[model samples]
Target: MNDADPLPDLDPLVPSTARVYDALLGGRDHFKPDREAADVFLSMVPHAREAALVNRDAFLRGVQYMVREAGIDQILDIGCGLLTKQRTHEVAQEIDPEVRVVYVDKDPMALTHGRALIDTGQTTTVVTGDLRDPSGILAHPQVRAGLDFERPIGLIVWMLMQVAEAEDPDGIVATLMAPLASGSHLFIVTWPDTGDPAQRALSQACLETLGNGWARPVDRVLKHFQGMPMVEPGLEFVPRWYPGDPGREVPSAEDLKPFERTQIAGIAVKP
Candidate 1:
């Protein structure tokens, strides 16, 4: 990967959601502003770091299931943050080297870092796009050329919480999924509001720091699936999804700490 300075026009003073997420994940691609934002978030939610780790682990598991069991050979990871250790392409390609992946993100830093790190060849590539513009992303030339729309595609919407309600998050999901062939899977990971006062406060803290962190209720989040059939163990806390998988051992949702229940995830298939 390129160890050079960030892009010339990129402002280091502004804390990007992607960078703050990277900082929360204990990654090295964040700036001082991002680290400060992450510190503020952690102060509000003491288990923020642990929640981030759980979210990443759940995402990796979802990717593995999509490739190994669901027979999905191509992926479109929307709002993909900075390049992490076990990224979508890495996990999917490990199972099958021919798997194709297209990473999309609005953060300039993420795009720059991804371009420098991941191979932009036939099997993998990164594109600059915003989640708010689903049509634009779907029409991206690289995205169009990288994968076949005629077959099943795995759509990973891991940063939906970063999109506020005013931005039409549900419509965004619908638009992104409408064109895909049947049998395509939709994997989502987002913070869920469980009506707890503490959770509301945490959501406020996130909004103040991230500018677009809107934690939706479980029902509203389920609407993003657009009536598709959810995979077994439907939308649940990150730690509880597919707990039977190797290396994933956790207590029941009722036994989980308040902070441990901050995030929720699930996979659904278009019928």
Candidate 2:
């Protein structure tokens, strides 16, 4: 069997991808190298920080909605970044006590820290697995321990796909969602290609360089939900999905211009 590549070290001097995201979200686990690289990212996509924060907000909202509103008891959070104080399980179980959450990340450090952040007496768990191999994560002990696949599970793939290459993203998502029955739903958020040439080019290049460089157009993104039924708001900007009263809404895609840069969000159910 071909084992996956080992996770990176705690070399704060290297400025890892997750640490860069941590810096963007105002987290403290990063160092000078991460800060420097993040600064470069900001310069390339000016609103990169804002987009990260907005994306976090969307993640919290999605978990809350699924747990409280959708009655989803099982949740699998893929590519979950550094498990800081603000955790998905912390947010979701607050609404429904029986909620089960499994945090999956290819980073070994993330696995250690995420397990640490798991509150005692809670159903939350963590595992080291890559998104490219969805079933491996599903078969992980932590995933099996916390979740029941026979029931509907809410799959949260937040702000993670932009880091995946184009040739296989849709196929990857399909594989992940394939396990769930008809009621299972998937939530995905990503940086989209805006009509603004300058913003689009800058955002594309930055993601391409830092991430996997495969940000897709909205059309390609919609293709991810090819056989699913969309929720009320459908797939759109991350900030626009069922925002609270007087929420932020971009009337048109153009109106959804990047504040320097912006990310997109979508939710669809398996038919």
Candidate 3:
């Protein structure tokens, strides 16, 4: 293990953002506190589970696009929660066997669970790192060893930016992205606070209970990736991007309306 990667003490009574997410995704890697928090959120907003599933499905689409269309062979999945379903490495390496991936998260349980579930021999590694410290993540021994900083990479920040408000989300993104070479792509999924007042309240309650996340509007979130050129159907709902098939149907405004207030997703490239 790297010196920067320290094992954190697990608190079973407190609901971690990652564990709450795991419970939402129908995974059993959480404690009682996590389940209680998830249940409370669900009670407030019953559609949350469906929304999470949709976001996850859309995430896979983005990853597949990066590997098959964008020709990206390396990926850095930051804030990667517990390895529940189709993971970054599984999707990327399936397309290209030589693909290398690094999963970074601050949660020790997530790191430990990921190690147990994922095959490390395929140049895939799970390391403890905070997204707020972009410099440390970019320079971590695991990241430096597994990924080529000089080459293009698919950077996935799914529902991760929600955790950092003090860091100035835009600056955090910019700091990490500045070093990657041109052609590098950024895939982001954010939970934008754009719903009805009641929905917003529910979202806030969920965050307060689970801990360490905030919901921001899509336009405000887009400002973070100022210089990067977005792909077609830019900065739309997660379900809106390449809706029916990878290169097929383009989702309509009506198609996006359902998920509009819940989540937003986008893919941009460094020019």
Candidate 4:
């Protein structure tokens, strides 16, 4: 991995979703705008930080299951945010050094940082693409070259909530998965709308500050899988999935905070 190149000129006043997420994760790469947005979000939803941590932890667990248990050697992580430690490639490659991973994100800064932090050798690469345009991402030269469609791929869609309802999130997922060979798997983490006023306020705050994203109802979010067979413990709260994974200490459902219950995750496989 090489040092990141000098970033392009960008407005510090503008809040970037990736940077805001970094702020939520307690990372140091965010700017004033990002921190301000995060503060505003936290003011309304005090558990936002804990929720972010839970989401990340669950995502990493999903990656471990996909690579170490499911025996998937290739991963396509769509809407991957800023590069962070214990990310997809790190977790996957740790299990098998030859694992191939392609990180996809529309944020220029995220792409740049990912490119810098990752090995960028034959085993890992970062591509610039939007999740809404699944076809564009699938057809990207780097994506096609970095992964083989004939092989089972572990597709991670951790930020599906970023796509608005008008954008046909379900269709986007179907298009992305259609070309992959059977036995491929999908890992998803998203906020599920429970009609709570606080949740609605949080969704509105995200849309206003980040320029896009809203929480979908749990049933609607589940439809994104398009009837694919789910892995064990289907569509549970993020912290509840695979709690038995080594070193993970999951709280009981009754003990979980409200925000923890708001986010749901699951892994499904194409038969």
Judging by lDDT against the true structure, name the best candidate. Answer: 1
What tens-digit string does per-residue lDDT give for candidate 1 at 75-115?
A: 99998889868889999999999999999887888888788
Model 2 spans with C-alpha error above 4 angstroms: 1-13, 119-122, 163-167, 198-202, 205-211, 243-257
Q: Which should have the higher TM-score, number 1 or number 2?
A: 1
Candidate 2 to truth, TM: 0.86
The sequence of per-residue lDDT tens digits that candidate 3 reaches over residues 1-271 is: 5445776778888898789888988999999998998888777777777877888887888899889989999999999989877988888888998999999988878988887778473579998788888889988888888888899998987555465666677877888898898899998887666655533754675667965556677777788676688877777667667622446565665555443447777889998
Error of 4 at 142 (Å): 0.9
What C-alpha lDDT do the candidate models reach, one value each?
A: 0.85, 0.71, 0.78, 0.83
By TM-score, is 2 or 3 better? 3
Report the candidate with higher TM-score, 2 versus 4: 4
Writing each residue's lDDT as its tens digit, candidate 4 over 55-126 gives 888888899998888999999999888987778888888899889999888776787788878846589888
TM-score of 1: 0.93
lDDT of 2: 0.71
Looking at candidate 1, what is the lDDT of residue 257?
80
Writing each residue's lDDT as its tens digit, candidate 2 over 36-92 gives 878877777777788778778877877877787778887888988788867888898
Candidate 4: regions farther than 4 A off: 1-9, 243-252
Cα-based TM-score, every candidate: 0.93, 0.86, 0.91, 0.91
Model 3 quality (TM-score): 0.91
Q: Which model, 1 or 3, shows the larger TM-score?
A: 1
Report clash pairs, candidate 2: 208-213
